[model samples]
Target: MTKIVPKILEDPFGNLTIENVLEDIVLGSSPYQVTNPHPYKPISMPRGCGFHGNQTKILIMMYSGPGNINQRRHVRQTWRELKDPNVRLVFLLGLLEDAQYVLEDESDQYGDIVQEDFCESHGNKSTKMVMGYNWAVTHCPAADVILILDETLHVVSDIVFEYIRDLVTESPTRLFRNDIRPDQHTGNSYVNLISFDVAKQFHILFPYIKPKDENLNDYVRTVANILSIKHIYDPYLDHENPASFFAFTGQNVSKHLLTYPLNINFRRLVGRKVLYNEDIPHQPINENLPPNIHRPTRCKLLRKGAVQDQFLVVVWSDAFDSEQRSTIREAWGYPNITVKIVFVVGFLDNHQNKIDAESTTYGDILQVSAKTNKFHDTLKTVATFTWIAQNCENTKFVLFLDGNINVNTSMTMTLMKELVKSNDRKVFLGQVNNELEPDRNAKSLTYVSENDYPFDRVPPRMLGLNYILSFDLIKTFDISFPFVKYCSAVDIYIGIVASKLMLTLRNDERFDRTSHSSFLRGIP
Candidate 1:
C-alpha cells in the first residue's frame, strides 16, 4: 500500500501518498472525456522494486484489486512464459482497508506488485489503467510492448519480445497495437497489448480522460485514432479467437473454455488450426479432470454494476442466437445503464466466430462452455447459477428468462425491490406446473422409467422457458444439478430438484405460460 499523505486526489478513499508525481497541470485530457477536471498528482503508490530494466521486455500489466492475492499468486505460478528475461509481469493494484496487511506481505514477497494510491473501485478503472501506463512510462521504460491484462486470466503463451517485435515489424507502420480482447470491454482491456512507443506517446502526449463506463479503452481508442495506431488483426499471430482456442486445448479438458473467463488467449500458438467440430475430431472426451471441492463454475458473464445488492437479469440464449439477442437488447431496453443484461449460452463450434464477434461488440453474452442439447439445458442453467452463487453471493435476486421472452424490467424491478425489502427467501416465482407427468415412452428424450421416479406426477415447478429464483435458493438449487439426473424437460427437472430440496414452488399469475412475455405476470 502507498503511504498516507495529503495530495490533490480525485477518488475519495483516504489520506495517502502515491509516488513522486512531478505535476498536476493536465486536466480534461483525452478524447474519452467530455470535460476532464481531476488533478494529475498521485497520492500514493506501491513501494517496491520499480519496473526497472534496460533490456527489451513484454511487460504484462494485470489490473488487480488489493484483496486479489490468490489471483496474483495464480498468475505468478501458472505463467510459465515468464521464465524468459524478455517477458515481465506486474500486478497493478489500488488501495483497500483491512486488505492492505495481506497485500503488504504479498508485496514484500514479490517485488512485482505496483499498488497505486487511489481507492480501488469499479468506477475508477480508467484511473487505474492510467496509473499502469504512468508506471510503464516513468518506471518501466524498457518495455518493448505492454499487454493490458486482468488478474483472473490464465495465460497460455510463451510471449517473447522477438515474436512480438516480429509482429510489430510485419504489421503496417501505422498499427501500434495488438488488441486481443475478444469481448470489447472498455473497448477490450482484459487482453489488449500496446507497443512501447504508443504507451509512451499516450503517457506523454495525451490528456487524462475523466472516468466513465468506457474509460481506459476509450482513452486508448482516442490515442489510437489520433496517432493512426492500426493493429493487424491476425487470429493466430496477434489475437486468436475460439477456433485457435479449441485447437490448442482440443479434447484434453472438459472444464469448458469460455470466451469470458479466458478473456486473454495469449496461448502458445505453435501448430494451431481452425477447428470445425464441436468436440475433438479423433480424440475422446477427457474425463480425468481433477475433482473439485465445489461445483466448477462454467458461466463467463461479467455483470459489472451495482451487483453488490442483487443480480438484475440472466437471459438464457443459444450461441447462434445473436439476432434474437440483438432484438432482446432493444425489446428489453437493454444496454441497461444500472445493471447490464447477461446472455447465457452453451458453446457452438461453427457458430463460435459469430458468438465471439457479437461478444466483442456487445460484451454482454456470458458463454457457459457446456454442450447444447435438450437434456443439457438444465445443466447449463444450473451451472450458471452455481457459478453465480460462488462468485456473486451478495446478489439478492435473479431473473432467468428465455431469449425470446421480452420482459418489462421496470415492473419486474419494482417487484424485485419489494422482494428485497421483504427479504423473501426460497422464492420460485413462475407459472407452476404442479401435475406434470414424465414421458413414459421409451423413445422420447425425456422418457422416465418407473424405477427412476416411481411418483405418479412430476413435482411442482415453473416451465424452464422463463422463471424467477431468489438468490437464497440458487445455491440450494445448484446442489441438485450434479446429483439429479437430467429430465426430458428442463423445467420439470428443475421442479424435481426443487422437490428434492423441499423448496416450496410459488405460483404467480403474472407468469403467463401462454404468452411470449411472462415476467410481466399480472398486468392487463
Candidate 2:
C-alpha cells in the first residue's frame, strides 16, 4: 500500500515535491495510483477479458464505504454472480483505520476490492467516484462504458446490458464521437452509467480540489452540458424515494425493468391497476395560465431575514382557488412585527406557473417537491414540518394553518405566547380528538391497512385545520419524519406520533373550527 497525499503542498507519510503534484494535476494523473500496489490487479476477472473483443465493453463499479463489509458480501452473493465478460463488479472504498483489518481480509478472500488512499467521509464521496473514473480510464481502458452505483443497490445487470445493447445499436455514432453538441440531460449520480469517453470529459472539468459544498449531481450536469451527451435515465433503477422504506418493493417495479431487493409478501401488498378498464377520459384541468412557462428558483426566496425575527406561520395550501389564498392574506396577512406568513404548497402541474409567479411577487411561498397534486395534502404535513425545522429553527412557535380556514392570527399568537410562558413542556395545541378508529375500509380511498396503521384505536391528535407547533415539538417531528409511516390523514398521523412520543396535547377552544361571527363575511 502507498501513502496518499491530500494536497500538493504537504504529504503526511512521504515527501512529494509540489512541482510533481502540480504536474500530476495538469497531466490528468491519478493521485490514487501512488498508494495502490495492485492498480490494475483484479480479485476476479472475466476469462480472456470476457467481452474484450466487443466494441462497447462495460465495467460496473460501486462506491462503497470501508465499513460496509456485510453489504459487500451481499453484493458478492447476489449481483456479483451476474458478472460476465462485459460486466465486472468492483467496490471502491477508502482506507479507513478502523476498518482496515476487515477490508484487507475481505479483499484477500473476495479479490474484488479497489481500495484508494483517500480518507472517506460524507463530504468526500464525490472524490471517490472521480478516482474510480480515473482508474477506469487508466487501467480498464478497454471498457467503453462504466456504470457507477451505490453498493446498497440490488441491480439486474441483464436488464442493464439489454438496454445498453439496444441503445448502442440505435445510436452507434455516439460510441466513437467526442465532438457532438451538448444537451441538457441531467441525471442523478447515485445510480448512472457513462461512456468511457464521456467520463474522461467530465474528469477534465472537475477541479482536483473540489469546491465547497459541491453537489455531485450538479457537477455531473455541468459536465453533461459540456459534452452534449443525452442522458439515458432508467426510472426503475434510478428513481428511488429515499424517505420511504417501502419504495424499493417489487410492486413499484416494472416487468421490463430492473428493480430491487423486495420480498414476496410485501410486494404482493401493493395495489394493482386494471388493464382493461372502460375508457373514461376526462379533460385535463387547465389553470388558465400562459403556455411554455417555467419558474426558476429565485435567490430572494431563500434570502435571510425572510422568516427572521418573527413567529413563522406556515399555511398549508393545495390547488385551492386563488380567491381562498387572497382571503386568508387579506384577513390575517396584515403588517405585523411578530408574525411572518409563508405558504407551503405541493406541486400542481396545471397551476405551477401561477404559483411561481405568486411566489416571485410575494417571496413567501415555500414550494416543496411533491410528485403530483394528489400528494398535495399528505406531503404538505411532512414538508411543512421539515421546512420549519431547517429554516425556522431559531423562531419561536410555528402556526400551521389551512388555506380555506379563517383564523385570528392575533389571538393565535396571544394563546401561543401564553402557553409558552406558562408551560415548559412541548406545546402541541389544537382541537384534540382521542381514540378515533383507523379507516379500515379497503375499498375506500382513505383506507388504512394493518401494515400502515396496526393500532385499533387512533391516538389523541390535534386537528390539522389549525394548530400551533412549538419549537421543541418541531424538532422532535423533524427527527421522527424518517421513521414514521406516512398516511394521507395528517391529523391522525400526527396524533399517532404524539401518542408514540407520550406528549400531552393541549386543547384550545379559541382555535375554533367555525369562523366567529364578528370576523365572518369580511373582516373589515
Q: Count the backbone clashes (under 3 Å) in each candidate.
A: 14, 5
Candidate 2 per-residue C-alpha lDDT over 1-524 given as tens digits, one digit per residue, 9 for 90 to 100:
12333442244466664345545556867453332122333322222224545646777788788898887787777765655567667788876888888777887787667766767687776777676766666667676677677776665433346445544555543332211112323433566656676676555545533433446666565445434555543332332321111122232334211111111211111111112333223222212211112222222233344333435677767654556666666766444333567777666778877887787776667777665543345566666676666666556677677676666666665665665465443678776654346678988765667665554545556754677777667766655444445655667667645533334566666665553521112222
Pairing residues by index, what is the TM-score of model 2?
Answer: 0.39
- Residue 460 of model 2 has an lDDT of 55
- TM-score for each candidate, following the candidate numbering: 0.39, 0.39
Q: Which stretches of candidate 2 lie over 4 Å from their true place?
A: 1-310, 333-338, 373-376, 423-425, 441-447, 514-524
* Model 2 clashing residue pairs (backbone): 2-35, 43-111, 50-85, 182-228, 183-228
